[model samples]
Target: MAATISPSSPNYHASISNTTINNLFDDSLTEIFCKLPCKSLFTCKSVSKRWLTLISNPNFHSLFLTHQHTLFQKTQALGEDLDQPSFILKPYNALVITPNSPSLQLGPLENHLSLSFLGPNFEPTNIVPQLRSVLKFVFACSNGLLVYGNPRPRHRCIYHIRNPLTKDSLELPCALTLCDHAGVLVGFTCDPYYHLETDKTKNAKVSIFSASQRRFRVVRIPAFSDTRSAFDVEVFYSETGKWKNFLVSCPKGFACGFFLTASSVEHEGKLYFMGGGRVLVYDPYENERVASVIELPRGFGEAYRGCLGVSCGTLQLSEFPISPSSAFEAYSGRVWELKHCGKGEETTTTTTTWELVHEFCLPEVVGPGFEELKANESENVKGCSRILAFHPYVRDTVFLKFGDNIICCNLLTRRFKVSKYGGLSLLFYPVIPIVIPWWPTPIPALPL
Candidate 1:
């Protein structure tokens, strides 16, 4: 009924049809592609424009992250299960970049990369050429960006708001005039209400820095004469770029020592300070108002001092009901939940209840002689021993510091394992081109 097609036309048609088939399965194919090494992943991008797009999409990026996390979990499981214990104490001396977004991969680099560890003796190892030189203490990372602070004298004690994955860093200047004596830099996430005046004119207040500024000016807080007691400080965000501080009363003679620790978490548009066995919530915008204090469980009042050592100011909420409320404290070998609600807010007045959810105590995995250190016993030790929470999607993982040794705990399973070697700190890098389940996959499904 129609003109016969030529042999050459049929061959061309078949080639086009094959490509369409590949495009249809691009998401699945990209997952397979991300498993390859970073260099190899780059090379595979040239296979077709469709492949390139699939690799770059944020959805596909999430797939890669998930794969990487899966691989890491698998590796850790294998190390634990191995009978011969072929593990090597290789030092990973590089910047640890953890992304806030479960799907977004940092930089153009793959999810995981290897770096030379400098060791516990503070010896300098051969530098990895591809990695950055600036060593930053990264606390919390989100949306492809990281919240880091440099404690060195050379860097002027500034916080580097950066995206290591993208190699983009922003230097946020210290808000305090006395940067040298600034107890600690606490970062909070709060939503400040912004209002405009009448007469059709916009009321501009504090100015935050734009990308062009590179370095943002510090938001000045009113100075206090008492140096012995630490002040509860927080940074609030509004429509404009400015920092507003809200101060809360502290215990007498609590300032000189490390009593108050900053938190990297922003809960319900507010920043929190943990100290004196209490959680004080502050609203940066409402400077005139008093801070709300949430009392800790009775047992935690004394127990917190020992287990809550090494104040990095980073708090991670557990997935399961570790405590009565969704909130729980992570430190040392234990995971504590809010057992009872004390007299405080309207929320607390109604429910003066105590509920036992789950308690994860560190297992005696460190050999027979090591007795489980009580919270009080460990408090006497010196130096920074922090607990870092790594959120890689479904499972919540926590890092514990006991003296120099670092222990990693899988919150989902409540299993604990120690690092191969002891070091000052442990940072998790999300964009180093390694396979982690949280990383984005190569190809993503399109929206219907």
Candidate 2:
């Protein structure tokens, strides 16, 4: 009835029945694969040519993204001990990556094979014989992508845009003109509309991240200008893969000194750069030529250090004044929130105002070494302190640094705790905070 089959025969396994997975339709397969973690989906590509083909399809990516987003909607914030303490500080000195990616793993046959951090456009002049990789100096982060560049001055800088979650790196073409380090400002922003509410299942808010359909822009403003505040700004679009020059001159008298050390925050659909006692607002998506500027609550001078960040869906700025303290011998940083003060929300940047939100002190919870300063009321010499960052999701939590010691203070509770990540470079490599949304962001899933 049946032909005799041997082990070497092509039809030897024909008599065996296929598994349920093999019988699944492409759409059905994708639906199931979407439920699994992203890392597992990547490994599934090795199962068979059919599985690889299904996962590689662009349509499959869209569906998977939507389904993952649905799962996110079902989850609740602050449900666990992690009141979403999910934000991470990405530094320029560290090219931190997950060791779990299959493509990033190094093989003994090829020593030091991975240099994706440097981007594809630039070539390194020298490398250690046994070194495995070279790190980068990260400039900015938006959505889930990162912008880092080559550090060698001789090599200038070839900027690289990276999706840390996907390991996708696009090497941007060299800048037409390198903005000098004196007072240059660089900012990154991703389109929020691409991540708008989709999948008519849940009443979910738009995600703080964009993936699969994400489009971003990298803005580079010219160096310091003492004359008029007008300058030709460069805008890079990921869709066209090109840079277009545009002039932004909204309000004059906008000056920023040592802007390279300042931090920028992106809220709603615009980027807010705080420096020179002013906040420069730029919308890379909608407004083509308008760059609105906002005045700070208090003029920040050399005696004070400032850090800008967003918390509770509003913009919050912290100022660390190395000045005299009215209360305890040791002074605490002052927090201010940008408020819409006028009659209605119709006010622009020029009309908006900042209100003092909270004044926090370093709690003794951080242990010893602070009593001497508090006891020495006359030694009003303010210890070297800095406002590191504000908690992205937390209401009133902010990170501070006193020399090498890192402390996290909650303005609501007036308490403080030392951060594990201390002794970082106090000068060049400032630890920039990148917020991780509830579900898709990597900081929560991956170890720092």
Candidate 3:
């Protein structure tokens, strides 16, 4: 753990005394050590109790997160990991996305992030007591942490906030809900900045925003029947370890099934629920009303579907033109980019701006058992074609659920491949795609 050069600089051979290392001020050591790789930091801990205390401190984690958001994320190449792939920033990211974020969509992350909580091999029975069920689906994901829930009916399941990389997890209290899972819209996000306490909105009460600002939130909008009507929303703050109810309203015009079976993703500092027809936005830091809503560029009719994702620091959406199961008949998909439009359109409820990024088709497959699958499609059975998630790195590729198998299709390559993770009676839920860092984020222990 001692990071000392021999007495002769490069040619030195004498170990530096622990006394000399401990002589440095805590701040000085922190400023220097935070820049080291996570593995090196861990090894440095055995040097002394002072090193252990410095590395384990919350303040030090905050500092480490800042460094990752800036220089560390940039130096990492796309589709490649560092020599030491054991560095991940804490969950309290403050809207600081770097340019090379596309790397998050590496080939295997979508499957791993979706199934990591079941234990090392993504087995269904590999669950913690707190994670009661065999894992229904990921509620929300930010940075590298996931809010996974059980498959109990009526949304009556427990949620566990877990960092698979670090193997750190926190069990949240039962959800405060007046409706079922289909009736609710859930999102997970952590404090973005360190100074959010003083950065509260106007002179409003800042109960939800803490000073450490390192806490995460699991927000559930239980009811959304009447448009423009206010309803109770339950939010669980990690800092206080309690669920606080707040009344908020959403933009009008969308129907009830808009957010049906949808999952939330934290983008920038806000939460986005990729609804059936439009995107429902919510900001946890401010306002009793919902944040700006974004309308999709085209229709995602009941047959075809769409999924939202972030890659290369830009908001992207992939819309399937036709169900992949119907590849034998028709095959087409589209990708769109979300961007800010020109100002002066304040009269509009949403600043609608989307550019068609890519349109692709899948190569046809000829094999046995195709006729049986096609027959199921013709009968209009349930779970025909569902888009689970967009590839985190590759924009054109997407993960789709046809029946018992989750297919990873690359629109650009026109290829189809089946994942080894199937044949289970798993719930039909959207896969929560996460771009994991080299090191895993740690779940801070909340006060009991």
Stretches of candidate 1 above 4 Å error? Answer: 1-144, 151-157, 173-176, 180-182, 188-239, 245-263, 267-269, 283-290, 301-334, 339-398, 402-404, 410-414, 425-448
Arrange candidates, best lDDT first.
2, 3, 1
Model number with the top TM-score: 2
User: Which pairs clash in model 2?
Assistant: none
Model 2 TM: 0.69
Per-model C-alpha lDDT, please? 0.37, 0.56, 0.56
Using TM-score as the yardstick, the better of models 1 and 2 is: 2
TM-score for every candidate vs. truth? 0.49, 0.69, 0.63
Q: Which runs in model 2 stand beyond 4 Å of their true positions?
A: 1-35, 49-116, 119-136, 151-156, 179-183, 192-214, 225-227, 299-304, 321-331, 341-350, 364-384, 414-417, 436-448
Q: How well does model 3 score by local distance difference test?
A: 0.56
Q: Per-residue CA lDDT of candidate 1, range 36-134, in tens?
A: 654455556798787788776656544554455455455556544211111112343222323332233334332323222212323322344411222
Cα deviation of 162, candidate 2, in Å:
0.8
Ranking by TM-score: 2, 3, 1
What is the Å distance of residue 385 in model 2 from its true position? 3.3
Where does candidate 3 stray beyond 4 Å? 1-137, 154-157, 178-183, 192-212, 223-229, 256-261, 321-329, 345-350, 364-387, 391-419, 422-427, 444-448
TM-score preference between candidates 1 and 3, better one:
3
